[model samples]
Target: MENLLYLFILLALGKISRRLSAFPENTPQILNLFVIYFSFPATVLLKTKNLNLGTDLAVLALTPWALMLMTVLGIRLIAWYRRWDRKTEGTVMLCTGLGNTSFLGFPAVAAFFGEDALSYAVIYDQLGTFLGLAIFGTLVVSVYGTSTRPSIKQIILNIIGFPPFLALTASLCLMKVTFPLPVIKLLEGVSATMIPLVMFSIGAQLRLRQPFSNVKPISLILFLKMMVFPLMVFFCLTMMKVHGPVLHISVFESAMPSMVMSGVLAQSGRLNAEVANAAIGYGLVLSFITLPFFDLLLKMFP
Candidate 1:
């Protein structure tokens, strides 16, 4: 409980800093790029080098991917039925499906499930969320976003250029190689900055001035993201008969709020800023209530 308060305090401080212009506008984006292209990959490589891959690992990793893909498609279908414009449709799809499983989800999981469960969470996050962002996420951003198709070249470059993906490749290929203690320490130090930097960047990007005309749509999307999505994951895990740490981590990942990258993509694709802001804002606000519910569910799960 105290730890959760600390997390909220840090988020609030980040927001306050942004409002006060403590950092330049572009600083967060640069930091985000560094994390995405460098720190995250190093963290993955350093952390998951000795991960004992197993059937449970595969199930935990794949569950979120399947759930997110289904949610995205379902939202798109609903948007189509309602005749929503491209911007609204795109915003709804991204916000409802993609989650901040790494940034916010990791700490919450660590608090509840401890350090050992973090490795499995990383696999679920990087292999599932990061890859989903590069491929399916990119496709959605491109399809409903701009007038032109995002080139295959661009997508390939993004997937290949992502530091985490490269790190995963390196870890798999060089599993036998041993790094010096000093080198490992340096990597660990840098990796530690990824989360706070990501959360602060998210705080900086939040726009609270968006109109409330679409309050109903925003609330519905938030409900799906913060509530329905996790429920779906829980049902799926039950059907699969997953238990213990893997089960706990699956629910934790499922319960994360919407991804900040959704808003970034929305801005890039020229989607409706109002809808995008609403989705992110409401998602963040509601996660405070929903995350604890998830924690309770995990405690009660057999």
Candidate 2:
């Protein structure tokens, strides 16, 4: 409960910052840059070290990608069918396709399932969603960032230069080398600041009074992200008889709101920032209702 309170309070404080004269207009953007460059990499590097690659671990990590694959395909098909503009398409692409498996997911899972569950959360996040951020997020932005498609070279270059991707690659290479205790503590300390900062940024940037124009796409995104896809994951996993924490956690993660960094990605890519912000802000509010509802349903099976 305290964990959840932190999220709501931080978000509310961020929203309140707008009314204060001290915060500049660009404060949220600056926070985004800091998150992308510093906080994100620190979290990745800290969590990924000493990862064990068992078959079960592989399944845990890959579940999010499966969700991402469905989301990407579904969004593209819908966008093509509706003839939505590229900006709207791009907004839906990044926002729907990734889950907030780190910031919000970490605390939410801990609150429901207890702290031990966070080990699985880390696997799903770092291996699955974090990579999605560095790979798919970057790819979508590059392709739909402007009217002209980027060259293959440019896309590759963007991925390669992406700071979080670089950190992920480096973490993979350093898996066996144990860093000194001081270094680990420093990384942990830095990574701890990520959620508060991100939530604040989301609160600051998100407009509560969303435009009606974004209603259709945002509604679709919420439906898929918060409801349909997670239900699909639940039933399918249950059919497979995949019970225990794996079943619980995977299903819960599938239902998380859109990745906050995705909003940052859309803004950075020059996509539809308004739609992105609206989707994220609304999704956060909706998750509070939907997550507990799903939790109750999961307990039925348990």
Candidate 3:
């Protein structure tokens, strides 16, 4: 509990620093690009290089991805029924579909479940979250924001150009290669910085004003993100008879707040900024309540 409070305080400090400092508003994006391109890839390459890849771990890791896809489809159907325009639908899809699985989920898992759980979190983040972001996320933005579908070459480039995705691919390819101890240590040190930096960037990007007037739509999205998403994960895990840390971590990943990048995407794509901001803001604030309840529920499950 004390650790959780400390983490929250650290996040608050980051937010305050963003407002008070003279740093350019673009600093977060620049840093995120650096982390994504450099540090994250280094980490992925270092960690996954020797990971004992297996069918069970792969299945466990994919649990959240399947749940996310189902949730997105359900949200899209709801949006269609409501006759939402493309921009609104895009914003909702990004918000509810893309949880803060990397920045927020990893740290929380490490804090509660210990460093041993970090590997599972990484698998969930890299193979599940990052892949979805590169493919499904790009599809959502490109399809809803414009009249023309993005070219296949564009999609390929987007995935290949993504820093973390590239790193994951390289690491998996070089799994048999061995590095010197010194180099391994260096990679670990650099990789350790990714989570805190990503979290701080999230805090810095948050803006209260953007989500101000979209309470109703925001509430609907929040319900799906916080409640429906976790339920879907739980149902899947139960049906598969998954147990222990895999089950717990999958539930936790599903319960993560909306992705902060959703707002950044909305701003970049010129979509509905109000809904994007609301989803990010409300999701972050509400996760404190939802996370603990999910944790308890996981304990209750067989």
TM-score of each: 0.75, 0.92, 0.76
* lDDT tens readout by residue for model 1, 13-42: 667877675677776567667776666666
Candidate 2: count of backbone clashes, pairs at least 3 residues apart or interchain: 0
Q: lDDT for every model?
A: 0.72, 0.84, 0.72
Model 2 misplaced regions, further than 4 Å: none
Worst 10 residues of 2 by lDDT: 50-59
Arranged by TM-score, best first: 2, 3, 1
TM-score, candidate 2, is 0.92
The 10 consecutive residues of candidate 1 with the worst lDDT sum are 1-10
Task: Report the lDDT of model 2 for residue 62.
Answer: 88
Number of the predicted model whose lDDT against the real structure is largest: 2
Q: Which of 1 and 2 is ahead in lDDT?
A: 2
Residue-by-residue lDDT tens digits, candidate 3, 1-302 = 44345445645665786777587767767766666666667767775676554677886567657866776778778777987777887888888777788777888888767889888887787677766665566667666666455687775766566566677677778778888899898888888776566556556665655644466668877898888878877887789888888888888888887776566556555577557765776677788899888888888874
Segments in model 3 whose C-alpha atoms lie over 4 Å from true places: 1-7, 17-21, 82-88, 101-123, 130-148, 209-213, 240-246, 259-278
